[model samples]
Target: MTRSSNAPLSVVLAGGGSAGHVSPLLAIAHAIKATVPEAAIVAVGTKDGLETRLVPAAGFELAFIDRIPFPRRPSLDLLKLPMRMSRAIATAKSILRDANADVLVGVGGYVCTPMYLAAKSLGVPIVIHEANTKAGLANKVGARYTTFVGTAFAATQIRHAHLVGMPMRKAVATLDRAAERAAARERLGLDADRPTLIVTGGSLGALRINKAVAASLEALAAAGIQTLHITGKGKAVETASGELLTAPLYQQREYVDGMEDVYAAADLLLCRSGAGTVSEVAAVGLPAVFVPLPIGNGEQARNAAELVAAGAALLVDDASLDAAWIAENVIPLCKDDLRLATMGESAKHLGIRDAAESMAAMVLAASGK
Candidate 1:
């Protein structure tokens, strides 16, 4: 609202808590910089959130505000909500003013609620990107005040929503998996000529996935497949007898920075179906078996629904993802070269590669500068 049409734009982006929120938020920031080289991009987040580390690392100025979470049930915390919200909104207002924010872009988190309310009161243009198939409470509240809304999935129930897909880091958005495969395999120490599966349970790891993969490792090795199993920080797949379970063809890694190498080296991805993971995997055309975490209103399952229906990915219940399921479904899928190729093609067809640019344009347009 402060910038004129010919002047460089100033944008405030708010999203925090999880990497799911921060990843897409950073992608949008990168896109905005690409389009408007002089644009002032200020990211607002709680000090306690991942943004403290991630935003500064990504070369953006980060501002902090108090987090005011909505209570789910009747409690004394609910009674104290107004005072907390007021303080957070006041802090958000200061950040917007300091940045001369013409537009406030929110990817939805506890940080966004205060920022959205502050932006509404200050008459700054609001643009929102909801990443989940089912909108979160913070984004739902934001949608009520802003017509400029974009979503990762088609079925997100926000008023005047645009299905612009998830914003991806430029590296991931433009990845050429087939072309990068050889070097990527080399980088990950994977066999370049062998069929490969990458199983990642994310940073905190999935106990069910790690256990199942550990149990099925011998079978995977017999079928001539190599695996890069990411067990998360300080966690690993262990035997029932409390022994570290590993195989010769199986590699255990704690994490992969940037994720491009892992994606390129993978013939198939076995992971959870969080919105960011689903969007990234589909965009990269990696055939996948999605194990949606069975929590939070079943949104993860919904996030994977489109790809699963397209045969780009397969979905299985979290409870059903055991050794038998991996052997019966995953091993056979990994062994089928023709099927993997088919699924990769299907995934590529459904992916929107330009989402970062598109979302950037949407936010810029809403700035009215």
Candidate 2:
């Protein structure tokens, strides 16, 4: 019944689909390795998620699980839920038994439900991490079975939640923008001395945000600011004449591989207020103008709530984000170094630099290590 104290900890982590889930999962795994060098770590994900690529790339063994999407309303999928859950639970039991799993960690995804169920049956301790202000269904179900639940946001509504902040990559957690700004700017072909602004809507980009940035390009350039706009795949900004918009003092890319570099080089950021973006920006102490995506139950707004309240960031509605708004708000803010520094300091004060280590310690404790 007790985890073997002499044995290396065997941990099974479940949660994957988007970068939001996978990125923190990887960060936690790395932190666990840092703490217990000989710990055996395995990730549970679906065959089609970003985890399929990211998990192995991070040098962890990834176990595939059936994707069981929860039905929001009455549907055929809901009718077959019993049989599907039974099969997935059986699969999860097999995975845990084979890995000799001492503890199961769920990070709020579809893959986590079955893992939580299986772990509960096997008497394996469960640790849950909810990354959003509002808990997801999977985490809600997982939370009922264990008390070691951690949250990225203090406002997150989870059972027995402890504030552990967001587990972010070490690159971002350890970044010193002041020390790396010049080199990062040089690498991106930006002027080292000039104020730089970056606009990103994450991997797939945000069309409305891209368009708004495009419309305000002239104003930003006129303010002696350089821009790096990552316009997601196939969502390129075009000119009035129907060609790709390639203006001077502005750079555009479909995506950038290493975002930490962009974070380091930028003087200001204009981005959507996803949990990952909010956490990373705060961790790097990057002053930002967050345009909370005007969708999905206002969780994005909630994610930026603490930072905005602390004067570390501004939250603009998606509809209010236009050329004029950018000109009036972002342009002026980007040029005010004293204000930016103060905001950055406020953000750093709120950012949790050791969340991964904290979560890792939580995992080790639950494993009886």
Candidate 3:
């Protein structure tokens, strides 16, 4: 049952819709291919999802399937739901068969559901990775078909789940922040000795976090702490008039392409507590103040709970995050070197740096390779 190094096993990773799902899919795929260069790696996604751009960019073949959203309430879309799902499943089954996939990996999204069902019908080994603390619908259903479920968070409520951590890209998982600090700081025009904090709301931006943090730049500057504020997309940088707006101490951007370098230079992070964010921060051992998004299944809060409990991070309510709160809590933490260092160490201890390799091993085992 073993494949030689020259003829590696094939893997089809199914998940899309958002970066959260696609990120881990690529990470695992990258891990598999890196370990076995001859492996044929393919990504299953819809034409409209983020995967269309991301999968191919990562050097994997992108296979298309029609997106099938399970309609919630009764409507025209609901009436069409069954047919849509059937088509998607048929498309997935065809993709699986054509690829001669040895294993189908689901990363828990709407796109994954169809692939999971198709994999089961085709008698292909199925492996699932759940990133959130609360299991998504796709993972919940996929779990029943196999016991080889991997989870980012230890407490993620997925049946047959084992803690394999979030599979992050090699650039992130193997980063040596301290070693890269000088060059990383220089890249951002930041002083290596100055306290640096990174405030991000996870790509789309958080209006409240932007406003609150933007308002506190003066206090942060006065405390000798510089900040890299990722104002999300299209948000105006609303710092106080005059010098503060153009100060080198406060850098603002809509997005950062080189996030690993940013993580390397940062001393503290103020951001939302999404599963991927939590895992990435923990992997880098960055001390953070997590602000869970007000909406959703309360999963964001649950995602940060273990880290907070481990003294690695602090969680703040969305409603309570204001300029005054940042001054009171965040600014002081920036000045406290010992506290940040201790928290960073604690966070690193809880992180799983080898998750990509571990998850790849799981996939190979399940495939009986």
Model 2 weakest 10-residue run by lDDT: 1-10
lDDT of 2 by residue, 1-369 (tens): 223455499999999999999999999999999999888889999999999999999999999889998888999999999899999999999999888898999998999999999999999999999999989999999999988998998889889999998999998899999899999888888998888999999876898899899998889889999999989888889888989998779999898888889999998999999999999899899999998888889999999999999999998999989999998899999999999999999999988888899999999889887
Screening candidate 1 with a backbone cut-off below 3 angstroms (N, C-alpha, C), the clashing residue pairs are: 1-102, 5-369
Each model's total of backbone clashes: 2, 0, 0
Q: Estimate each model's TM-score.
A: 0.96, 0.97, 0.95
RMSD of every prediction: 2.1, 2.3, 2.8
* Tens digit per residue, CA lDDT, model 3, 1-369: 122345558888999988899999999998898787788777988899889999888878898888878777889999998889999999889888877889999998888889999999999999999999999999999999999999999998889989999999899999998999899989877888999988999878998898888778788889899999887777647545533345547888888887788889999999999899899989999899999999988999999999999999999999999999999999989889999999999999999988888889989999998
lDDT of each: 0.90, 0.91, 0.88
> By lDDT, highest first, what's the ranking?
2, 1, 3
Per-residue lDDT of 349 in model 3: 93
For model 1, how does the per-residue alpha-carbon lDDT over 248-292 read when each residue is reduced to its tens digit?
A: 799898788979888899999999999999999989999999999
Per-residue error at 147 for model 1, in Å? 1.4
Q: What shift in Å separates residue 322 of candidate 3 from its native position after superposition? A: 0.7
Query: Residue 108 in model 2: shift from native, Å?
Result: 0.7
TM-score of 2: 0.97
lDDT of 2 at 340: 96
